[model samples]
Target: MAADALPYPLRLQGSGIVLREWQPDDLEDLVTMLDEPAIARWTPMPSPFDIEAGLAYLKRAQTGRLSGRRIQLAITVDGGEPLGEMLLFGVTGDRREAELGYLVGARHRRRGLATAALTLLSGYACGTLGLGRLLLRIDPCNTASTSVARRCGYRLTGEPPIAQAGPYGPTSLDTWEYVEGLPGPRRQRLRNVAARRYGRRP
Candidate 1:
């Protein structure tokens, strides 16, 4: 399982956000998150995403979890209402790399929800899952997502944009990469009793 995908039906707690698998009760809220003009513009999520589309999406998400093909989570706070979605897909065979994507409801934007959720999930993917790299494909025009990716430590390289096939067919996107671990040495030093820890860049 470690080499194939994330732990099935995962749940994680962060400082202010929670990452969890989809549930039956989240159907309506799922619709709320995906069925928006912004979502349609930025994502390959089904257009006119209604209850029917939500049902299909729920089935797909659950099945993906069961098959260990990919993982998607509901982004929430205090385990309350579902406000957005975060997903890791296109996993490499060794599970050392994968693509990450997220969406927040229109009403829930501009509150640092995306940053909180992405930061939490990125930590899990690197630390718990031992992933060496996570990829984020973004359209340059979508400044909101670009900002979120940058804030969460995803960096754009000289690598040219690639065309990826999605539910909406092929689209060109900028590739942003997130490598595991912190970039610099530890700031605080322990005295003779202990050793200070530093992170290694992948």
Candidate 2:
């Protein structure tokens, strides 16, 4: 799909959280959050994240949106104070599927913010964007992320884990795939497509 055809700078709101496009003003919070050791270890972000890296990331996010490749949003409360970030990328236009990624700041952990962000993003992808599947690639060792996936109703596809290259090195990661529009023919279709794409049993 063309970049103009897709919704760039999308904004979604939930109970207490809002997911919207990244802003230049979010740089400080982005650097602070991504600088956490746990965030670097679990996510693909650069180690020793700094202002420069944060600026680069913002630039890439803007470019990705214009290219129709991804949408990266800042997770905030009441549309103020960025507490985290989330993204939907690696979109497959033919399959109507995309990957989901997110991280909450160290101080903001365990407050259901990530879950709320995921919920809003998934709803937008499946409902507004009319996408069929959303895939979350998570490290099996990251129990927190797995918990979020479960809470958001994502299922284990039973597919073999794959390796993701990060700042430290390559680490094996599992795929937690979410298929929306469940409980009917659409659900079965999504399940079948997910199974086939991820090498899971149908």
Quantify all predictions' global Cα lDDT against the true fold.
0.77, 0.81
- What stretches of model 1 exceed 4 Å from their correct place? 1-4, 164-171, 180-202
lDDT of 1 at 196: 17
Q: What is the lDDT of residue 126 in candidate 2?
A: 87
TM-score of each: 0.83, 0.86
Candidate 2 residue runs with Cα over 4 Å from true position:
1-5, 183-202
Tens digits of lDDT, candidate 2, 1-202: 5743457758888868988888888889888888977888887888899999999999998888777788888999888788998888888857477899989999998899999999888888888788877889888788798778767878666678898888777778887778556667655654565456444542
Model 1 over residues 82-171: C-alpha lDDT tens digits? 889889999888777889999889888899999999899888888888887788988776789978976787766435777665455566
Candidate 2: RMSD to truth: 4.5
Mark the 10 consecutive residues where model 1 has the least summed lDDT.
189-198
Please give the RMSD of candidate 1 to the true structure. Answer: 8.0
